[model samples]
Target: MKAEFFTDAKPLTVSKENFGLERGPLAHVLVNAMLVSDTAKGGSLQYQVGYQLVYKPDSPGKKLPALITTPDMSSFCRLFLERGKHYLLGGMLDQNGGARVDLCSLAIPWKNVTGKQHRELLSYRCD
Candidate 1:
């Protein structure tokens, strides 16, 4: 399974909200991330942490790639998401219609968690 996140943040632009286009600055990079089942042994999430990086400095250059990792050596307190679950992300945007989003953290943390490293007792699927 796979997941998708969207945002309008300008983390890549030094202008704070602009992509350096109005200011004629170099471009920063952005990436896409998803939450999937971490099907590793003794894994609590049954989900894998993955990301799709956006790079290349050119128009639509290599639209990033989806990345995933096993839940090996992971713990609780970081279960901002679950397996087969779809998350909605938002952030600042550029004038040229590009999103400068950050994928390393969650704007909202999930309440269904304990001090232990684990996900909620459920599995999800997309439409």
Candidate 2:
């Protein structure tokens, strides 16, 4: 017996809002980070992260060397995004078009993703 196809089936279309890019530029990539330094000032914590880009964007010379500030220290601690670890970061671009990963950005450990998933993410259009 042969299986029947459902002609009425429709493909699901995901909206850009689902990716949380409705308000800003989205830059997603894998990175290895090293903590350069961190400081607390006026109840806010700032971290200087030295990161190496694992995925280069379509436009050359667009990737920045570091992440200057992560607004909330508690959130940063919760994620445990420490130095010497690789993370898949989904960040927004600043006024200068440099990617900034902070409390609001999505940061996941690189070890958890599969190779296929990594390839798909790398091919995604950030612009």
Candidate 3:
């Protein structure tokens, strides 16, 4: 599968613009993980991919969810993460406390994460 499915895709920057404006505290999670599974949910066509946390630099020894939902974006753009591949994922915690990521969020392959990009992602405040 082509990792560059999202043309002009860039690493996420450290800015409030990357997060939602929803009221209440936002718990952002950024981790280096391996894509464990990818499956389309029923008829909705949305994918609920699972990832094994390989590294969580911000919150060491903290427990975090392994699965993150990917909204169905077939109409526009979609992120297709290959199982067994490592990725640097960053996303906000939804109201349900579940982690959700999409084409708009940081979902870059581990090999593609540059030193600068890694530092920038680490700079973000992760709860």
* Top candidate by lDDT: 3
User: Against the hidden reference, what TM-scores do the models get?
Assistant: 0.22, 0.49, 0.48
lDDT of 3 by residue, 1-127 (tens): 1111111112344456535311111123233343433345321122333444333333355444555556444554455666556676655444444455557666767788789966764565546
Off by over 4 Å in 2: 1-58, 75-80, 96-99, 125-127
Clash count for each candidate, listed in order shown: 18, 0, 0
How close to the true structure is residue 54 of candidate 3, measured as C-alpha lDDT? 33
Query: After superposition, which runs of candidate 1 have C-alpha atoms over 4 Å from their true positions?
Result: 1-61, 70-77, 89-104, 107-127
Tens digits of per-residue lDDT for model 2, 1-76: 1111111112333465433212222233333453433354433333334444444443455445354334445655
> What 10-residue stretch in candidate 2 is worst by lDDT?
1-10
lDDT of 1 by residue, 1-127 (tens): 1112322222354564433522111121222344345555444322222322221223343332233222333353333444443333223234443432333323223232343412221222223
- The 10 consecutive residues of candidate 3 with the worst lDDT sum are 1-10
| Model 3 clashing residue pairs (backbone) | none
Where does candidate 2 clash, by residue pair? Answer: none
